[model samples]
Target: MKKEYAVIGLGRFGGSICKALSEEGLEVMAMDMNEDRVNEYAKIASHAVIGDSTDESVLKNLGIRNFDHVIVAIGENIQASILTTIMLKELGVKMVTVKAQNDYHEKVLNKIGADRIVHPERDMGRRIAHKIISNNVLDYLELSDEYSLIEIVANSRLAGHSLLDLDIRARYGINIVAIKRGKEVIVSPLADEMIQKEDILIVIGAVADIGRFEKREMQNDY
Candidate 1:
């Protein structure tokens, strides 16, 4: 069955999610206290309504409990975000993802049983910092505080070698899950698969281990 999603607070974060989900042909309900914001998304979302999600009665009337997932994206109003998340869980929302304003907010959401907590600003900053600091790191995705998935471009030092020859896993505790060569992608590359210069290696490992691998393999003068 197709999952149902509702985004409360028609701000940039919530509105972007509603549009992206709807673009993928998913049913999305866009809710907000501002009539203008709700109206703006009426044509984009499956359903758009102006109401305060923090009010339990409002959520009940909107049939929020039937949605598979609800995202609390209320801007600035920390109290409203917390109350809305609480109501959503109390009403048996299958998944409640809340956006945290800070560390304290995330702690509260975690204690209250939020299915997921997102710190957009903090996560984005980490991504940008990785790109700025590493010449070989093409991209980065944080799987958790301790682990990450990184894309690193192979250079002369890593070229002309195979997975078995490098023995990267034994040394750095990271896995090269895939290799992106121009337009083709090789997933779960075999030990004999040759590493070519400029190939994008999709690597995953603990953050500290990845950093160590980067310092030793990717950033050293050859």
Candidate 2:
């Protein structure tokens, strides 16, 4: 069965999601307060409506509760975002994801029962900053405040060393979850598998440990 998604706020964030969801054949209802924005997404999404999402009556009329997942993507207008999220939960929406402007807004949304909170700007900024700072860091993702999943180029010195030889888990307290070589990806690599220079290691560990490993491993190469 095709899933249904509702995206409130026709800003870049919400508009992009609606377009992608519709392109993938999911049922998407794009809602925004601006008629122009609603019209822009009309052809992209399954349905598009211009209405104030903070209004419970409008939401009820639109059957917002029927959507499998609702995304509150309102920008800067934290009040409207909070109100819409509260109304959606009150209407018994199964799942609600809100785009938060800050940590305080996220805390408030969570307390009001938002199922998920997204910090798009902050996340993107972090990823970009990491790329700028390190030439060997291909990508970075935060799994939690304390831990992260990072993709780093295999150090030349560490090349040809097998997982068993390094014993990363016991030695560095980090896990080599995956190895991406060119187009190929190896998940849960074997203990005897050697690290090739072509390999991009997907490691998960505490932020500090990962930083230490990067410095110790890639310092000379960079």
Candidate 3:
């Protein structure tokens, strides 16, 4: 059976999610208070409705509880987002995800039983900033406030060493999650797998340790 998802907002974030879900062949219920926005997505989604997501009666009437997951993506209005998330949880939706505009919004969503909180704008900004600052840093994803997954090029110092010789975890307190060699990716690279010049190492560790590895060790390589 196709997974059913309900997106309760018609803003860019919510609309993009609805479109992506539909493209992925999932059944999506796209809801919005604006009639025009709902009609626009009605063509793309399995069902699109004009409704006030913050209203409990409207949610109940839509049978939102039957959805596998509900995403509250209302932008600007933290009140509506929080209320909708709470109502959805009370309506017995299996999972609820919310797009938070800020830290306070995220905290409130968490307290209201939102299963997941996404900070799309903030996360993207951080990723762009990191890429701008370090030419060698290809990508970055924050796993937690203190930990992250990073991608950095294998510089000269690491060109010929095997995973066993590097011992990243023991030496730098990081793990090489994967290695990208040109177009190919080797996940969980084995100890015998050798590193090559320009290989992009996908690493995961505490943010501070990754900074150390990039600045002190990798940058100084000849």
Candidate 4:
């Protein structure tokens, strides 16, 4: 069955998600209090409506609880965000993902049983910082405070070396879960597979261990 999604507050974050989901042929309900915002997404979403999600009656009218997932992306208005999230959970929505303005906002969302809390600004800053500090790191995703998944470009030093030869798991405590070469992706790569320059390694491990691996194996090698 196809999962349905409701996105409250048609701002950058919510708008982007609606567009992406719609592009993938998913059913998306885009809502916002602002008529202009709702109109903007009318052609892009499966359904777009001008409604304030903070109002329990409004959400009920939209049948938001029936959606498989609801994303609360109300910007600046922290109170509205909290209220909307609480209402969605209470109404028995399967999942509620919210955007937190800050640490205190995230704490409240966690206490209220939000399924996911996103700090886009903070997370993007961390990703950009990692990329700035290491030329090898192409992208970064934080799985938790302690763990992360990163994509790194293979350099000359790592080229021609097999996973067994590098012993990355034993030495760095990081696993190359996948390798992206050109347009192909090899998941759960074999130990004997040789790494070549320009290959992009998708690795996952503790954040500290990943940093150490980048410093010792990638940065120092060149």
Candidate 5:
């Protein structure tokens, strides 16, 4: 069965989520205070409505509690975001995801029982910065404040070496979880497997360790 979703504040983040869910043939109701924004998503989302989610009555009228998941993507307005999240939880929405502006806002959302708090802008900035600083780093995903998963293009230095020879876990305190070569992906790669130049290494480790490995090993080769 397709899960139903209600997305409040039809901003970039919310609109994108709505569009993706609709593309997957899920039921999605997009809402925003601005009629213009609601109108824009009417053709894309299953339903689009102009209403203030901060008001419990408005949410009730929209049948928001019936949705399986609700996303509070109210941009800039922290108060409305908090109120809506709280109301959704109180009304027994199965899940509530919210976009937090900063650390303080995130703390408040956490206290108010938001199922997930996303810092999209801040996370995107970090990913872009990593890619800009090193040609080897293709992508970065923060698993936590200290740990991250990174995709690095294997350089000449890494080529012709097996995982056993590199002893990457012992030396760098990181793990090569997978290797992507061309269209093939080798997950949980064996220790005897050799790395080839341009092979994409999917590594996971502490942020500091990953940084050190990239700077001392990958970047220095070029």
Candidate 6:
């Protein structure tokens, strides 16, 4: 079944998510106080409206509670964000995801029962730092504060080694969940499957363990 979503902001952060969700063919409504921003997303969402989301009457009229998820991506205006979130929860929204402008904003959102809080700048910084630390790191995704999923390009030193040879899980405390070789992906790779240089390894583990594994395994002399 397709889920319904409503994005309550048309700023850069909110716009990107609205577009991505639309591209996936999901039913999404984009809302904002800016007439121009709502006009811009008219064709990108199932519906686009210019209105103040903190207004309970506007939300009730739009039947906001029926949507599966609501994303409060309002920018800068922390008070409006908080008010809108409180109204959504009060109206019985199934899930609420909010963008935090700072640590204090996140704490407030948490206390108000937001299901998820995203810090775009901080997460992007972590990804950039990982890329700077090693050329092998292709991408980084934080599963939580402690764990992450990372994509690493296999170096020549890892070419001939099979899963059993390296004992990756036992040695590095990480699991190579999948291997992407060109257009092919091997999921849950067998212990005997030998790795080839340049294969993209999708790994997940504790952040500290991944740093140690990358330092000792990926940064060593060939």
Best-fitting candidate, scored by lDDT: 6
Q: For candidate 5, what's the RMSD?
A: 0.9
**Which residue ranges in model 5 land beyond 4 Å of their true spot?**
none
Computed on alpha carbons, the lDDT of every model, listed in order, comes to 0.92, 0.91, 0.90, 0.94, 0.94, 0.96
| Decoy 5 TM-score against native | 0.97
Question: Whole-model lDDT for model 5 versus the true structure?
Answer: 0.94
Worst 10 residues of 6 by lDDT: 212-221
Candidate 1 lDDT, 77-153, residue by residue in tens? 99999999999999999999999999999999998889999988788898888888778888999998899999999
Clashing residue pairs, backbone N/CA/C < 3 A, model 6: none
TM-score of 2: 0.94
lDDT of 6 by residue, 37-60 (tens): 999999899999999998999999
Residue 144 alpha-carbon offset, candidate 5, angstroms = 0.9
TM-score of each: 0.93, 0.94, 0.91, 0.94, 0.97, 0.94
Candidate 1 at 91: error in angstroms? 0.7
lDDT at residue 143 of model 1 (Cα atoms): 97
Q: Local error of candidate 3 at 55, Å?
A: 1.3
Q: Tens-digit lDDT track for model 3 on 1-222?
A: 878999999899999999999999999999999999999999999999999988889998999999999988998988888888888999899899899999998888888899999999999898887777667788899999999998888887888999999887898899998999989999989999999999999999998998888777665767
Superposed model 1: Cα runs more than 4 Å off: none
Provide the lDDT at 145 for model 2: 86
Whole-model alpha-carbon lDDT for candidate 3:
0.90
Q: Report how far off residue 8 is in candidate 5 (Å).
A: 0.6
Worst 10 residues of 1 by lDDT: 213-222
